[model samples]
Target: INRLSSALIRTSTKCINALDALRSLKDGLDQHPSITKEEKERLLNFISVARQEYDEIAKKEIQKAFVYSYEESAKVLFDNYLDNIEAYCNSTKLKDPITDEEVSPDEKLMRSIEEQIGVSENAKKSFREEILLRLSSYARKGRKFDYTSHERLREAVEKKLFADLKDVVKITTSTKTPDAEQLKRINGVSAKLISEYDYCPVCANELLKYVGSLLNR
Candidate 1:
């Protein structure tokens, strides 16, 4: 009877230790920064399964020989749990948080066009080729415009490019020449674009001159 009692005591201790280890593992996983909410839930589910296994072992009829078997079973369960945790942690990829400040597709396209135009010796020549290429690509892709005519498509493209410019630069238009306030805004935008995008100053000036000519026409 003493031997049986001692065996029961050892088995109980082992079971308690296994449960504690499982709980500790779960707590660590819960606090991990890289572990996503879904991954954490997966880890918790495994821990719950380990707890169920331990509970079932504890409820069985106690014997001197059964104690060793229980201990061995508990060891195997906990070892497997640890191995799974290690694999999951190793396999899980941490992703950058999605931000609203990320550049939009339209902005990316505009930037590419701007870079192409700004890098050339003749801004007007570069702008004409870039615009033609874009229009040609759209035509080849069978893209339909609200207007039925090619002239309207060209007008729409110009409007879109300028509209996008307003988002990054403040440009208010009037029938007459730019007023003092308008010039100030234009200068502010020019400095900002040059600073932010490393745009060529001379090219930027030439581009603005072209835009002014278009608006006047």
Candidate 2:
């Protein structure tokens, strides 16, 4: 699902990393706690068009590639990541494009962007209070909050993403006796790598075979 995502989406031919980052940000806009409600809604509403276009263009392939194995855990990690983005955006200061700063990760004031996901002012107030309370509790326990704040959550997300990737790209276990359908699928995935991703036939099949071996183990 790496470059396949790029090819399927509009990330190819353009800077794939940039567009992928936007898509990721776009996905997290809902849970970011720093942006005001309005800003969040605005970005989501605006980005929805691009997301729709990507989806339409890659409808079939995406449907094939994007099944989640551990959906809930992955979702929780994603939400926390989005929250980090929001926190960063709300800092009222932008980092120098050339230099690294404290945030690697906005409350717009938190309301503007939070609104995009239907966070009301009342809910925002309550959420802010709750988060502060949680932070204090964590401090009391000598725990720092960050992306890896929840070890179990991180492990779950990693497993989920990896499993989904294997499902998408791992060829059958025994190519020697692959059934007709599997042979067809293997051919399709190989053709995809060769024609779309510019992998040579030999290299693509070799990669697929390596993947198949891992899955077999």
Candidate 3:
């Protein structure tokens, strides 16, 4: 949609420019002593209609561009959310065995799922790196920067990892409780990451510092 909108705008702009050139030619023609007033009036009216059409087209093009941008942003957000969910599931190590013929997902199939998840994670990492580079370039130019994009990227990465981990857990009729200490550590780590996003000048730097602190402890 964005591409289509851009094309429309480009085409409209060109048309408008051409119309302007035509009007200039008409004005030159009107200056001729031999030209009749009727001919001049006709040419001016045609130019007026053409200009009006160009303005309308320009407005429609702008609307289309805005719609395209909004849709694109929504899609990106959804993708990021799914990725985060997968990462969270993987981190939790919630998986079920398939050999018993009781689990929804079979062991072999689950392993394949994990492989796919890894591919997604690698892709997310690549995207995150690209965004970071872009953010850095913008920052150097003294432009405003937001961590929302990176936050979404990280969420997607973690969710994809979690989906694979979910396949590893054993399925049972009753819900099983996890170790409180492990859960606490996971929460703590996540909180630290969130803080880094909210407060740090450079997200990468903050992440490194947080990790270093964790290691030291």
Number of the predicted model whose lDDT against the real structure is largest? 2
Q: What lDDT tens digits, residue by residue, belong to model 1 across residues 84-199?
A: 32333344332323753422223233333334224343453344354455545777889742221344333333333434343322233222467776666556545644665454
lDDT of 2 by residue, 1-217 (tens): 4434544466333333334545666766655689898998888887777765544433223222222323454565546544654454354344434675643433442444344345576676554455555656788999875424544333333443544455543445346778887776677767776676565676556555544555566
Better of 1 and 2 by TM-score: 2
Q: Give the Cα-based TM-score of candidate 3 against the true structure.
A: 0.25
Over 4 Å off in model 1, which ranges? Answer: 1-16, 61-217
| TM-scores for every predicted model | 0.22, 0.27, 0.25
Arranged by TM-score, best first:
2, 3, 1
The predicted structure with the larger TM-score, 2 or 3, is 2
Better of 1 and 2 by lDDT: 2
After TM-score superposition, the amount by which residue 214's alpha carbon in candidate 2 deviates from its true location, in angstroms, is 2.3
Give me the overall lDDT of model 1: 0.43
- Residue 71's lDDT within candidate 3 is 41
lDDT of 2: 0.51
Relative to the unseen true structure, what is the Cα RMSD of model 2? Answer: 20.2
Model 2 TM-score relative to the real fold:
0.27
